[model samples]
Target: MRFEKENWDVIIVGTGPAGACLAREISKQHKKVLLLEKGQADLSINIPRMLKNNEMMFIGNGKTLVRGIRSGGTSVLYYGTAYDPPEELFSKFGIDLASEVEELRRELPLAPLKDELIGPAAQKIRESAVSLGYAWEKLDKFIYQDMCTPGYFPFDAQWNATRYVNDAINSGAVLLTNSEVTKVIVNGKQAVGVEAIVQGERHKLFASQIVLSAGGLGTAQILQASKINKAGEGFFCDPITIVQGLAEGIEAGNEIPMAAGMMFKNEGFILTDLTLPKLVYQLFSFQALRPHRVWQHRRTIGIMVKVRDGIGGSIKRGKVHKVFSEADKLKMQQGESKAREILQHAGAKRLYSTVWTSAHPGGTARIGEVVDPNLKSEYDNLYVCDCSVIPTEWGLPPTLAVLALAKRLAKHLLLRSYHRR
Candidate 1:
């Protein structure tokens, strides 16, 4: 492979929350860091841009999917709902994120949306859930209220990977945009560099440490390309369905999605408010074959049933092959039933879930199997610290947990001796 002129102390792949967080942390130690991004830089993250770009959306066999392919990754286009990863799972891997999570709690804007910020439809849904004794409560978010304007500008006011990317750059990290890393280059079981295509040209970058934080699918594919065993086996993506309803008089137009929800942890599902931006609402309406409903989008109310599913999947030829188990199907049905009950209570009619789609893909390359406790892979100096490292399907957004995991990994890699293969 051809080599670049510069050598880095650490080369991080993918600029998502996990990758960005880790890069910034390492750069703070004055290391020569390089961040490689698959997508182009300077791509504005907004509803319109997302709607127009085909590359931004990676759909797998019309089942699993992910969006927001750019310098900041999906964090740039998120709805802001956040959930903490189950601590026990990480503990089993000999890692803890409590301290890091605490630090972020104080730094990031993380709180439940205020009553004034909740939309009328969602408010009614919350009331109905409370009346039914489901213990539905406000969901934590990563948004700064004062930074947000009155309208539905999805790109602005949210805490995204871009902030950390900038922080890493300011702290002396070099970033290569449009550099799609295909695989880790291992020299006789020792990973020392990566081969990537940068703006139509192939380039090889060497580093003392190589970290892959390219979400589940991206990381899995990269590992497979390097002939890593079981790259995506035993992976899972939360099965989800959005139950749409029309609130008679309430205007839920372009409100924040997943404002509040009830969690039935043991039952493995959540009934949450699912409001979309105005244009996205119309797209959903059309996809539902209800073009007539476009006029009533302002009065539209939505309830999403996001449930954890059993882990069983394979990634071959850049595609994901997975099916929902009977247990998962049962949970989806239960969630739909609960959502319908709440929508009915809110005076909403014609309740229906648009379609079944998989949530963020993860657990592809697991902690105990693909990577060790320190997130180091089988090849020396190769590490993975993204959704791909998660060992279970928690059925929650992974930013907070992923960010903390990166911080923990950075500390471990610095404080401990590297395990040479």
Candidate 2:
């Protein structure tokens, strides 16, 4: 059978934040770039109906998580909470994030949710944190204020990757959806192209530079399939546990935002609010069918904690092997106790824990371990720009860090092109 061969100046896999950002930067310089995704492109997937119906389950490494698999990737399912990358953490990895911060401020909306928008449950939590004299603050999220209504929640304010992907496309970058890259074609330890499955047929795409933004798991899978197993070593995720609280005089509704405030305790753990769909409450709340008097007290809040994980994990064949160390477990327990304390102060009547919940999973391809400081893999012309490249367990979410790295890598790639000329 005959196959078609296409050449591009650059080919990026995954249309998430990193890929979309890189594509946008490169395309502005007039580079012929192709962005490939394993899912379909749809912005409206953020709508409640779409998200609930097409939720994909990812289970491995002793945890089960759900996320959207469409064109915008997991952004469609993300709670849209935008957190600033811890500057000190990136500096340790030899990354300068100052300029990235400036760019982010210019491009994205970052502010605390207004008082009117904060639900009664969240306000009580905040008040408790203040009373405890803990260092806490409202979290800024990427959201469109205009779209928010009294009873309607706008989950898209967080900088969804779809916007960046669309910007890249508008800037002249070609996008290929429903294309799964199966292998990286290498010659003499240098990657020159990729082999992908599109419409049940095999096709090849060549590029001068290849960037893997295929996310933590997808990046590891692609690297492993290409006989590059070291990329899967040292994988780390901020193993999180959600503690839910039942409050009095509160109803089970979607008015509450996903993330509102955060408390960073001295015990090296962080606690924040957690919101879920109404269906989630119906399934988890023990008193779901109580009378209006009892149901009025069905307020639920979430506390997410990040443990100090000394033992790094691994990902093999789409399986995540995360065995918590003694220290990690201890940290989680400590965080849980603190969360209970906060709930008690906030007048929580009952508390329950979720089965499995964690948003950020990073370090699958750590810097200086799997990929070099420049994010280039041991294989030539192959690079990674995603949360997978984080070197250690960041106590906070990693979207901002991933974007900073992508911006820096784009500059590096551009300089290389100039030098070659």
Candidate 3:
């Protein structure tokens, strides 16, 4: 590939929500930006393709960590649930997401699922929880309701980071797929560029500023490789398991997962309806040694028990080392019990819990420790705007919070660029 003599204003690694939003905002301001993604640009939701793109690693204690390695990152596989960023948490660090969050609300399609759009399984579970006085409520989703229908979860109806990536592209940002960045090239105290493998070829890209949005695990590895030793010292992956039971005469399994649920803040866990796809259901069933239930996707009703786990992990030599604390186990146990009670109340039977798995891996490069309140690393012109920068144990979907942070980072970067000129 021929080299461009001019350096870009910013180079963002990863196409997840944070990177996408940042690229979109920065490009809209007419800044020269380069976006790199390690995964292919394909966004297909089929089983074979997703499995191929999803890199699953056994972190520790038999628990697995999975994240999409394709364009749009894990948001392509997420349930599109939108949770506001914890204001107090950010306020403590001298960061506030109020303006960015409000701007996002005006831009994105975010609302609770309508009654007609709620699937039978989620409805049944909600009914049971409400009957038990648990205060289960409909969750806000990033779905375009006009594009959705009853009993079916349409992929296009759900919002993902790809939308922002496309917007960024339209605004003249350049994107390079299959480019895996290895490390940032720091000159003295300032980051000047990065070294990456582009389409299996080693490529060195230069930029005035480098922002790593390569996710929790990916960013930690790159930072460590770049000589930031404290990048991945400890982390948290909010572990989750589904407590499932068979409900007779309910045509379930096609609805959106996590559509309705409640948080047990005191218990340090959350419960939500989780109707997995047929393939995923079968995979979980086989993993749990329940071959008899492998074919019960249509009749299975499940509630996900996701716990706010303590930070006790490290990203070392391309592997995740993690273990749950005793408190984490107790929280999951209590959540599972609550889920089973709801299932039983809803006329479900043969309850069983699936193996533990985690989707969000974060707290690796923490805010106060690794990154500053402005999300800047110790080196100049380097920043991190992914789940890795979240300083606390987060149990909810972090798409909204990540997007908000990206917006804030974009404003800061643009202002800094203007000041430099």
* CA lDDT of each prediction against the hidden true structure: 0.81, 0.72, 0.91
**For residues 1-421, could you state the per-residue lDDT of candidate 3 as single tens digits?**
7533558999999999999999999999999899999998877666666556556778877788888787898898888999899898899999999999999999999999999999999999999999999989999899999987898677899999999999999999999999999999999999999999989999888898899999999999999999999999888888989999999989998988888999998889989999998888998998899999998899999999999999887789887888888999999999999999999999999999999999879898999999998899989999999999999899888999999999999999999999999
Evaluation by lDDT, superior candidate among 1 and 3: 3
lDDT of 1 at 78: 72
Stretches of candidate 2 off by over 4 Å are 1-4, 42-62, 256-259, 263-266, 283-298, 306-311
Q: Which candidate number would show the highest lDDT if scored against the true structure?
A: 3
Q: What is the lDDT of residue 407 in candidate 2?
A: 89
In TM-score terms, candidate 2 sits at 0.89
lDDT of 2 by residue, 47-72 (tens): 35544533433445445444445666
What is the alpha-carbon lDDT for the whole of candidate 3? 0.91
Q: Give the TM-score of candidate 1.
A: 0.93
Ten consecutive residues with minimal summed lDDT in candidate 1?
Answer: 53-62
- Preferred candidate (TM-score higher): 1 or 2: 1
User: Cα RMSDs of all predictions?
Assistant: 2.7, 3.6, 1.2
